[model samples]
Target chain A: MLDSLLQFLITGVTVGSTYALVGLGFAIIYNASDVVNFAQGEFVMIGAMVAISLLGAGTPFPLALLLAVMATVAVGLVLEALAVEPARGAPVVTLVIITIGASILLRGVALLVWGKDFHAMPHFSGDAPLHLGSATLLPQNLWVMGGTAALVLAVRQFFRRTSAGKALLACSCNRTAAQLMGINVRRMMLLAYGLSAALGAVAGLLVAPITFTSYDSGVMLGLKGFSAAILGGMGNPMGAVAGGLLLGVLESLSAGLISSGYKDAIAFVVVLLVLFLRPSGLFGKGAVERA
Target chain B: MHMRKRFFGLILGAGVLAAGSSFAADPIRIGTFLTVTGPASFLGDPELRTLQMYVEELNARGGVLGRKLELVHYDTVGQAKEAVTFVKRLIQNDKVDVIVGGSSTGDTMAAIPEVEKAGIPLISLAGGVEIVEPVKKWVFKTPHTDRMAAIRIFEDMKKRGIRKFALISGDGGYDKSGRKQVLELAPSHGLEVVADESYGNKDTDMTTQLTKIRATDAQAILNFGFGAAPAIVTRNVRQLGITLPVYQSHGVGSKKFIEMAGEAAEGVRLPAAALVVAEQLADSDPQKKVLLDYKAKFQAKHGEVSTFGGHAYDGFFIAVEAIQRAGGTDPARVRDEIEKTRGFVGTAGVFHMSPQDHMGLSVDAFKMVEVRKGNWVIID
Candidate 1:
């Protein structure tokens, strides 16, 4: 019984870590740009598939990974400049619709290009099973969890210590004031969006070997990551990570302990119920005052 | 009278020439419609690959009936309405001699009326018995009927001394048909249906449904869903730590399931087509050799595993066999030859199609497989 419980925890924590990465991207983008960046999952998908294909084609894994991340960051900058900047000062609903539309467009593009097959990439660390007590975890799972933690800590440090990172935060807190103080809010938005997409891509590449991904995988993953963001705390970076990991782990545990049939329903219900109980989410920045 | 005779003679000559040209070198075009994209793609994507592989093999084994076999493909997105349109295009625009495909039963069911209108041979890969029921003259199937699977499930459960069972099925057409079939047959197998829980395609939760099911005094669970749906079921079954025997439909063989469900999927029983289970059988067995070869070849080419890809593999190879046997691409001749196909070793098993049994196999064609340590293990 204890062995199975440990097993569930391992499974949950592993997937939860991936969710954390996606949610972190959401939180960072929201913090700077005040846009949800609904197409975040596509970045993850691009990173994983592009990296895998490049690696498969004999490119060094590190080089492929770097290229995938950079590619998404570039896409993020372009999307912000072309789409978001043109719709500046638009209603939040408009931004939502446009980003959702962008999500659909990205999905269509991925389908057309990739030709609809789930690819297999080699595990980041290795394929050897790691035994923890009675629970066995794949080495790749550790990489995902470690990578997420390191990313979260690095971002936290960057916001506190780096001048540019501080400028990005200042823009998020008060764009008008930041602009008045010559913080260059538009550039800050570009940086934040770029970083967000890059993070998503990194997460995707990390988990590529463990989970199967195809062109159609992005929408559902984006939804789940977004749900984690909302559940964890929409604008709070740490909260997004916490919420995602929590959701992933809870989902695994539910499937482990109860009926696998109800895991999806169970996870969503918990999210909805949590929202009802605490609107700010487990770690969300409480209610925000509209500018 | 002389003018009339000359005109009649000219018309006859023209008809004979036209017929002769059609018989000469023009490859008989076969149209394939499948879910090459979207969420249901896991089912169709491999199917398309298998189809491509078989077509290549047939071409290599000497062009079918001394004419090249041409396959025109389309993506159905696994929807019935999409299938209807695709079938129309296949018949009217592509001018195909035969239409084969249907990874999803709903799509196949929708394509039937259009195929009947075209007066062409239609062989479906989807396993819903209703697809052939009130049987259409031109429509045949390569997959065993869902009714056959229902019987096998109940019989397997009964054999294991499971007198009580619960059902967790999606509200899809195939699921509904299979569930109804199980209800009809379970009683004969000395099993009582304790509960029937349902979910929709977009549903992200089945906790309430599963909770209700768990409350019942059932000895086993029969789950029917595709993609994340059944994976969710498998996880929930584990989370609840329900010790009941869990059986999932073969439709859940997507790449996403293992990643999502992980260890919770261990020990789940599935009514797998013989093609997949043959991997666990002894190497000395001829069927095992075929299954292993198909798997090895498919993995080498496609780099992933699919449960029902063998259906598509079987479909393409069987059609080629018929074309070869008929010695020509004449639609009627090929159709008759296909109907008479017997003891032909296929990826799935020896197919024995008759005038009545167009699918060429039954429930017995499937072997029960269990997920053991993250791999499939054949059980009897």
Candidate 2:
């Protein structure tokens, strides 16, 4: 029984780290533009597919991974320049729809380019499992967890220690004031998009070896990441991590204990209940009156 | 001798005229709806290509039964709704004499009621037993059933004295049928299903499910998912370092599964049609000649021979034989003739259709195969 519990927890954490990465992608973009970019998950697919194909073609793993991240960063910039920038100042709902459209288009293009087969990559480290008493954890899980931590720390450092990052935060707070302060708000938004895409790409490349990657896999990843973001209070990076981990643990526990069939439903039901009790989410700030 | 030569030439001229006039009549129309362009395209594309190749060959030989064979095909894109719409279009608009399609069990089931109402002979490529069980008069399908596949796995496991088993399947129609079969058939085979878990079809990670299975004292694991899920499960099981014998269904029989699974697929076993391991089939096996011919022809034309495509080959031959036996392209006659088909050998297996059994395949039709050095080798 203890072994089972430990096993589920390990699996949950492994999957949670992946969700955290995606949640961060969502959180970062939400902070800058307040447009829920539904195409966030495709960044993950792009990263994994590009890296895997390059690896298949005999490219060094490190170079292939670097190229994959760069490619996704390019995609992120292109998405902003073409889709988001054209309809600047549009209603949040319309921008959201544009992102959704972008996601569908990206998914279709991926299906055509990558074909419909699921691809598996060899683990970056080895496949050896570290025995943790009753539960054994894969090496890839460590990569995901470490990568998530590093990204979170880096984002935190960027906001607190960098002038550009402070300007981005200022723009998120008040675009007019930031522009008056001589900050380039548009460039900050572009940077946010690029950073978010890189995070998603890292997540995808890290998780692909364990979970597998395919063209349509991003839809579920995006939804789960969105749920994690919402649960973590939307735009809060720390909240995204917490919500992602909590959701993953809850899902795994339910699947392990109650029923695997209703695992997804169970997680959503909990999230729904949590939202009902606290409308702004677990970590979200309740309505604050600005004087 | 001169008189005999003149008589032969006259007879040949008369034969040519008869053929030419017959060709002038309305052609026999056969419509197909398959998942030729979506995630399940792996199944549908080859099936469509094989059907097209066969139709072209038949047309080259003056078509089937004195009428030119006309094929109207649709890409269902793996959607059940698309399948139904195309089935309706095939019957109502195209006015096709017969329908051959439904690459997936879900699509086939969705199209069943419509085809039954139209009373057209519908030859399905999916392997779900429900498509034919409780036997709809107009519905016939090729390929072995999921129940037969499950039973085959159980029988093989029983022989090896491995009674306790773990079952992990995808929550799809085909896998659902497989799960049902294993649960229902386990008792008869004197086996216990120690653990039964399921994952979503598009689920990337199943280590959680595998972890649950690992807790069980199962002597072996049976994975009943289709597409990449089975391969994912295999990888998870191996990554978790569980060394118990793992078995998969015919769903993972193709080389694509092995490719996706890579090193993890090395020793995994599965129950699949002989078409998968045709090269390893014994020369004396009854299906060797037909299977070899299909593999050669399909490879020659399409550069690869997918086992799923064999379902279409069997379906086409069954329809043609029925048309020939009925002596016309009338739907009712063809439907009746198809019901009486027996010992009709094609790519998947020798089909024996009857009024009671629309899918004429039996458990014996499946071959036990295992992955060895990234290639499928016949085990039984």
lDDT of each: 0.76, 0.86
TM-score of chain B of each: 0.84, 0.89
Q: Per-residue lDDT tens digits of candidate 1, residues A63-119?
A: 999998998888888888988888999987798778888878887888878866555
Q: Give TM-scores of chain A for all candidates.
A: 0.97, 0.97
DockQ of 1: 0.09
DockQ of each: 0.09, 0.50
Interface RMSD score of candidate 1: 8.1
Model 1: native contacts recovered, as a fraction = 0.00
TM-score, chain B, model 2, is 0.89
- What TM-score do all the candidates reach, one by one? 0.70, 0.93
Model 1 lDDT, full chain set: 0.76
